[model samples]
Target chain A: AQSVTQPDIHITVSEGASLELRCNYSYGATPYLFWYVQSPGQGLQLLLKYFSGDTLVQGIKGFEAEFKRSQSSFNLRKPSVHWSDAAEYFCAVGGAYGNKLVFGAGTILRVKS
Target chain B: EAGVAQSPRYKIIEKRQSVAFWCNPISGHATLYWYQQILGQGPKLLIQFQNNGVVDDSQLPKDRFSAERLKGVDSTLKIQPAKLEDSAVYLCASSLDGGQGQETQYFGPGTRLLVL
Candidate 1:
C-alpha cells in the first residue's frame, strides 16, 4: 500500500519569508504526488501535483513543488509567503489512474507578521 | 464551471442518530468521491464512485456508513448510529477523467458534522 508522511506537525514562519514543507512518500512503482491546502473550516484546495515530467512543478497561489525520485520526496516551496498562506498542508499519493489517494497526517502552517 | 456541490453545510446530531449528506459532482465529471476529515488530520477517503458504480469503498465503515451515486450524477452518504468519533467534515469531490495521473479534482465546501 502507498502512504505519505509529513514529518512536521507544525511550522511557523514570518510573512514574506521563504517556506518549505517536507513530504515523503512510499510506493513501489512510479507515484502520483499532490499538495493541497485547507483553511479553517474549508475544504482542501489543490496547491500542485506531480505525475510525470519536470521534477519541479508550479502550482496556483505562488507555490511550487519538486518531485525527487531519489529520496522518495516531493517538497513544496515558495519564494515568499504571505499572511494568507497560513493553512494546513497535506501531501497525497495516488495509484494508477484511479480514486485512491493516500494523504499525509498534515502540517499546520502559522504565519507571523 | 461550477465546482462540486454539497448540501447542509452544517449538521448536528446525537450519538446513535442518523444523518445523510448529499453531493452533486461537476456536470461532466465521471467520478465522485467522499472523504472524511478529522479536526487535526488530513481528509481520509471514505468512498469513490465511477459513474454510479463503486470503484472503492475499502476504507468505509460499512456497518454504520453507506453511500450511493444515482444516474452517475448525484450521490448521498448516510451514517447510522453515529458515534462521537463521527464528528468531522465530509467533503465531496469530482474529476472529469477519474484518472489519478493528471486529472484535477474540484472540491465542495464540505458538510461539517458534529455528534453529541
Candidate 2:
C-alpha cells in the first residue's frame, strides 16, 4: 500500500517570507504525487500534481513542488507567502491508474504578520 | 462551470441514529468519489463510482455505511447507527474521467457531521 508522510504537523511563516512543506512517500514503483490545500469551511483545492516528465511542477496560487525520485520526496514550496496562504495542506500519493489517493495527516500553515 | 455540489453543509446526529449526505457531480463528469476526513487528519476514500456502477469500495465500513449513485450523476451516502468516531467531514468530488493516469478531481465544500 502507498502511504504519505508529512513531517511537519504545523508551520508558521511571516508574510512575504518563503515557505516549504516537506512530504515523503513509500511506494514500490514510481507514484503520482499531488498537493492540496483546504481553507476554513472550504473544500480541498488542488495545488499541483506530478505524474511524469518534469521533476518540477507548478501549481495555482503561486506554489510549486519538486519530485525527487532518489529521496522519495515531493515537497511544496513558494517564494513568498501571503496571509491568505494560511490553510491546511495535504500531500497525497496515487497509483498509475484508478486514482485512489493515499494522503498524509496534513500540515496546518499559519501566516504571521 | 459550477463545481461539485453537496447538501446540508452540516449535520448533527446522535449515536445509533442515521444520517445521509447528497452530492451532485459536475456536469459530464464520469467519476465521483466520497471521502471521510477526521479532525487533524487527511481525507480517506470511502467509496468511488464510475457512472452508475461501483468502481472501488474496499475501504468502506460496509456494516454501517452505504452509498449509491443511481443515475450516474447524483449520489447519496448513508450511515446507520452512527458512532462517535464517525464525526468528520464528508467530501464529494468528481472528475472528467477516471481509471486514467492523470485525472484532476474537483471537490465540493463538504458536509460536516457531528455524531454525539
Candidate 3:
C-alpha cells in the first residue's frame, strides 16, 4: 500500500531561522505529492502540490517543496521561520487521477523567539 | 469562492450514543471527502463521493459509520453507538473533480468529537 512518512516528530527553530521538513513516500509508481499545514484546533490547509513537470513546486506562505524521485522524498523548505509558522505539517501521496490521499503522521514545528 | 462548510464545531457524546455531522461542499465542486483526524495523526480518508455517487468507502468502518451525499452537494456522516475510540476531528473537503489536474481540495474547519 502507498504510504507517506514524516521522519521528524517535532522541530524547534528560532524566529527568522531557516526551516526544512522532511517527507518520504513508498509507492509502486510515481505519486502526486502535497504539503499541508494545520494550526492548533483547526483543519489542514494545502501549502503546495507536485503532480508533474517541475520537480520543485512553489506554495503559499513562502513555502516550497522539492520532489526527489530518486530519494522518494518531497521535503518542504522555507528560508526563514516565523512565530506564525508554528504548526503541524503533513505530507500526502496520491495517484495522478485519484482523489484518495495517503498522509504522513505529520511534523510539529515550534518557532521560538 | 466560499469554502466547505460543516456543522457542529464540537460534539461530546458518551459511548453507545449516536451522532451525525453535516457538511456542505463548495458550490459546484464535484468531489467530496470525509476524513477522520486523530489527535496526533494525519487525517484519514473515511469516505468519498463523486457528485452524489459513492466513489470510495473502503477505509470506512461500515459496521458503525455511514455517510451519504444526496443532491450531489451536501453530505452527512453518522455513527451509530459511537465508541470511545471514535474521538477525533472530522474534516470535510471538496474539489472540482478528481480527473482534472487543477483540482485542489479545500477543507472545512472540522468538527471535533469526544466520545466518552
TM-score of each: 0.97, 0.99, 0.98
The DockQ assigned to candidate 2 is 0.83
Report the number of the highest-lDDT candidate: 2
Scoring model 1 with DockQ, what do you get? 0.67
Q: CA shift at A56, candidate 3, in angstroms? A: 1.2
lDDT of 3 by residue, A82-108 (tens): 899999999998886656888999999
Q: Tens digits of per-residue lDDT for model 1 on B1-116?
A: 77888999999999999999999988999999999988877889999899989988999999999999989999999999899999999999999878655677778999999999
Per-residue lDDT of candidate 3, residues B57-108 (tens digit): 9999999999999999999999998999999999999998866544688899
- The prediction achieving the highest TM-score against the true structure is 2
Ranking by lDDT: 2, 3, 1
Candidate 1 docking: what grade?
A: medium
For model 3, report DockQ: 0.65
* Native A-B interface contacts kept, per candidate: 0.59, 0.73, 0.53
Candidate 1 matches the true fold with a TM-score of 0.97
Pairs of residues clashing in candidate 3:
none
lDDT of 1 at A12: 99
Worst 10 residues of 3 chain A by lDDT: A93-102
